[model samples]
Target: MRKIIENYGSILLLLLGIALGSVIGLLTPHAVEYIKPLGDIFLNLLFVSIIPLLFFAISSSVANIQGENKLGKIIGLMSIVFLVTIVLASIATIAVLYFFPVSSGMASAGVMESPTADNSSWGDRIVKFLTVDEFNNLLSRQSMLAFVIFSFLIGIAARRAGAAATAFTSFLNAGNEVMKQLLLLLMKAAPIGLGAYFAYQVKTIGPQLFGFYAKPMALYYGFGIVFFFVFFTLYAFLAYGRKGPATFWKNNIVPSLTALSTCSSLATMPANLDAGKKIGIPPAIANVVIPLGNTLYKNGSAISSILKIYVAFSMLGWNFFDWNTIITAIGITVLVTIVAGGIPNGGYMGEMLMISVYGLPNEAVPAVMIIGTLVDPLATILNATGDTVAAMLVTRLSNEKFAPSST
Candidate 1:
């Protein structure tokens, strides 16, 4: 009973929150509005924690890479694989949207004010991304992409610092662990916080929020399921042919289910590691690649990001076929998705980047958040399962012999 609750508790709580929130919204709209602050406070807490979480988690992971001789090769190969998969996923998203376009009726939804001014040139935006005032950017929620870049450089420098880096790396790792504990504590209160927020959302938008976004949601889930089976199978074949494909499915079942239930790839890491061992991946490779991949390889989020951009463009009546728009959409999707971690609503930062980079209406942020929240389980399953697949590829490419091993 304890084990079952431990596995399913969070998902059950989330569903309960949604159901109760909807009822309150319908029966007591005014009261729901009053409860909105609880939700706002919860969201603000999450936002405040995410910057430091990304910084320490990513930098520490990078700083801990053990094989100095093989580090460059391993990281390069893993990155190539990650980039290729994300690009393919993005293309799949574009193709899916092309076939089943989002409804223009989304324009009728209430538009929030666009947050940033739209006068910045592409060159100016690029410059700002690379050279923001570090102290100021650290405080602003909008600077996550820059923050990730800065943290990554710091991590690499720490890796090169030899024995002197151990203390700093230990500190970052400890900080990351503390943040995870904080997240768990927050999650325990999520039912109340999310319930209040959802109630307010239903009150403001009416229950029609679901119907308003139905078509795009359908597209997202439909394509997501298709991609998971097809893409993972292809990856299995590339890693080791027929035998590998069979092992992939057999090993991934538990991790896939955990990811789906938790809606969190990071939360699924233990299961992924177990699956990696079952499938004969070397522990050395699995340990390094799985953690690193959790931070960097986000094919699932890349697909979701593409869909968000399409939905935003559909709502705004932008020309999707424009070359400049297409390039920007794909580029930012890849960039933001890389940093999209496994927390619920973790993709919010990525959505903000999309809005800023594409000059999207700030109102689109909430819509994207709604979409991400609804489809998080599916996205997470793909993200978590894909990490194991990446580990397999990395192991095979590195010429690491697959001997069946368990912790």
Candidate 2:
């Protein structure tokens, strides 16, 4: 049984969460009263792990990347890819909202926040809400960006300090390793947390909630999956001319599976590296691109953020055409979401962050949560594929020639 769970844990837990959530949605009458705490617990648990995990993983990964000679150019191109992918995601989200507008009443009907009489004006409120750290605070109420920034500083200091920071680096590396193990252990409880969270969400919201933005959500997810195929095919055509795409999946499926099972690009690094090497990607290219990909290749999560923003705007009856809002949403999504693609269970947290930033209706929060739970697997697949694509793209950008036996 343990072996079975280990093999099929993520998928099994995800399904069980959905089934339980749906049942709860179907049967529970006052889901808001009882389900809130459960959602909070799951989110809290997930958030507590994010900062530590990101700090060590990103700092260490970045350190390893910069050690490479052509690292500057590689990092630049990867950053561009990350930005462009996020923009595309934002566009896809806006398009979904425009195409299938969910009624505002669906969100406004049931809840109430005490109206403020001051009316300090929308401009003032917008300015405050749009602050960078404010959005981070909204999600986990922790300073994720600060933590990441500090981690980078520590990594740089470690390299510069030589032996002084050696002991520190060793400790951090060990902490990261231990935390990874803890993550594995924490994931064992995902089914229970997800089940409770889902049950609470669906039990309270009911199936009708799905109809609001379900079509658009599906479209967003479909676009990401389709991109994976398009990118893989393009890589095949470019690298091997007419025949490469045919064998791309054959050599890379194991990495993809590992990515799916693990729900992390970083976690699947070994496999991705192995697959890339098998396909003639050199150690130089693999070493540089794979790690950078972890920080700047969140095509899946980016797309989800875009879609969620649109949904939120639609539910709030806000003009979706506001350039400032659109631009800001895209910018935040791009910057914060770059590395988030590889994070297990990150999409939901991302949605919460975006929603809070926009001051979206509280009623719509559960809807976004439900979507996150449902789409985690697809998100995992896209995150993995995005990394592979980045590796190929970065290699091409760096003009690195791959030999048939390069691995």
Candidate 3:
């Protein structure tokens, strides 16, 4: 039906792209390599827009937080909840790994020379993050965290600009809207671009990639499902007591499914907004929190980060169980997930951070990318679901009526 197609057209196209790419790679890999450039071009286009988009979107959101009373309280509560969820996700990842330990053989046996490895201590890494050249950092993907920090500060300054804050916030908001429109336009080519990319990926890595990672991937998904049910159930109970569980699922199933199909929290925002209304969340809270959570609240991403770190350390024959390493991994996972964008393959940025901070082998970069891409949809489902639950909690804590009483 036209309605069904309209509702799910993008996801269908992406799925078709993936399928076609796999077939081409399997049957005529030599020919498929020629089209790989299309995928690269698409990725390049996305990378080009990311920095400005981050600045506008993140800064504007933070700046606007000043306009609403108790919005800060909502944000404060949400922050604690978000951090708790991420920590829980990390704990789940650790527990899963204990039961289904990743084999060392998942890593390529060949040794790779890492060009980015350095002798910087954790303190040095922190100092470097806070001391980057602002203009230069904005122009480079390698300085994403630094750029994020700069954006946050700029947003706070804009918020405190008194009467001038309104115009500044409007300008940044317009820019953010324009960037999102640009991304949507580029996504129209996703079928062709992502298909080509996947074809080349299959050709280069072959089926063996899946075979080697099967157990680990399975473990990730299994634990992810457990986390989703456990956390959301508890969140619902806390927000609305007995009726909360049913209401949460009733309203969120569609949004969760949309996120799963698109692997994009940003794309699922409209549906989430509608779901928030149906569940009695105040429009003011939903407007602020859903968008903010899209960019910052990434419990799913935190779990993925933790999983990737575990795999990377296992590959490198490092002691993952050491207290120091465990604590450091938790810190890195929290930070990286906070900065992860809501686009497909957005976690690639976080993976890069992991590599730089943890001294992971350069070869592990590609492996992490591949793994993250493969699991993006499920991760996104958890992310979208969490956003809705967050809205519920915000509604409860702010003591707002869910819906207006019939006049």
Candidate 4:
């Protein structure tokens, strides 16, 4: 029992904190404001750490990589896996909504304030989405995708420079280690940090969940549970057959809980990175894929987009099943999910896409946006932990010989 506790201490503590916070939120809904700041401090710490962590982790891994083609192959396979899984998530959500359906007759919903709106052309928005206007913009958490691109470029350039860049490579590696240790120290506070955040979330959002949001929330969460357990299990199995699932589940627990509590993919990146190492993925793949996944991965985003669209349709009395509308909505969801994660105000951007494409009223934005908020915990779990499994699949497909847990 002592040994078990020793091994599982962090997760046990995390779960306990979450349970306690949840109870507090439920029993006393009026006090989350005081608790919310504790959570914010933790999240801010995570956000601040991410840029350096991405820079070092990705650049160092890529710089240390041996064969040039190996990196290319890993990325190619990783893209395919990301796309396939996202499509599956989106389609699955559509299927469930077909059977279960999500309608609230609350088409008149509107927020006290409007979401951020960008009037830029699609071509311009796409360009800005991937590349920033200046170097300083890359440092912001909002420009994560751009920073990832910058880091990847730095890695590729360094790798090409060969022996000339060896000293720089060492610096990158050292920085990665330092940032990782910092993350470890940061995680020591997660039980309190995330527990506080979860309390606020439950207190503020709990009542809404029980109201008109219940039906769609139920549908989203029902599918989320299946996707988290069943599909993730299947992906693990495929990555290494029988041994894969056990390895994944073992290393994945803390990351899963972290995502559930914090509802932030970037906040969960360190745990995913650790899990990737334990799961035997090459650092080149894990470093690039996990961080990149935080910026661009679509499993959770895809499902959320679909549900948001369905809710709007059902409320507006439109036939969501219209083959053309379904096709169009799914396409929009995929596009939004793909591009939305990297930018500031991404959720608002996604809402904009849904409203514009479906030609819905502005009021529909807040209605569906709440769904994203309510479902964020599970959605983030899928987004963050899915990166670990993705790295496994990429390793296998790239011929890297990843045999489950290495630890």
Q: What order do you get sorting by TM-score, best first?
A: 4, 3, 1, 2
Writing each residue's lDDT as its tens digit, candidate 3 over 182-234 gives: 86687677777767776876676556446657766777788888888888899
Clashing pairs for predicted structure model 1, backbone only: none
Give lDDT: candidate 2, residue 202: 51
> Tens-digit lDDT track for model 2 on 1-407?
99877645565656665566566656664663565476557545655765666566545544544353554666677677656655765676566556665443346433333223334565764344333444345333233334445566666667667667667777777776776676667555555555565555454334443654566556765676776778557756665656467556655665564454345555555455556666666555555456556545676677667666665666666776788988887876875464253455655546655665677656667656655655665666667665665666666666776654422
lDDT of 3 at 50: 64
Q: Write the per-residue lDDT of candidate 1 for residues 1-407, one digit (tens) a residue.
A: 99867655665776687678778888988787678788768666756766676676557767776777666777777888888888889888887788777783566555444344447786886676555765776555455456666776787899999899889988988986787677667666666776777676567644543677888777888889989999898898878767788888977866664565446665566567667877888655665577667767887788888888888777777778677888888899788766575565587657767777786666666667676666676888888789889988987788877776532
lDDT minimum window of 10 residues, candidate 3: 109-118
Clashes of 2: 5
Model 2: which residue pairs collide?
21-198, 21-199, 24-203, 25-202, 25-203
Ten residues in sequence with the least summed lDDT for candidate 2: 109-118
Give the alpha carbon lDDT tens digit for every residue of 1-407 in model 4: 99888778888999988888898899986787888899999888988998899999989988888886888887889899888888888878888888887666566556535556778898998798789988999998777888898999999999999999989999999999999899989989989998898898788767777866888888888888888899989998988779899889999999988887777788889999989888888788899889888877857778888888888877777788888988887788778766666322356567777787777866677788777777877777887888899888888788778744434
Candidate 3, position 393, lDDT: 87
Cα-based RMSD of the predictions, in order? 6.6, 8.2, 5.9, 2.0
Top model number, TM-score: 4
TM-score for every candidate vs. truth? Answer: 0.65, 0.58, 0.67, 0.94
Against the true structure, candidate 1 reaches a TM-score of: 0.65
Worst 10 residues of 4 by lDDT: 339-348
Q: What is the alpha-carbon lDDT of model 4 when measured against the actual structure?
A: 0.82
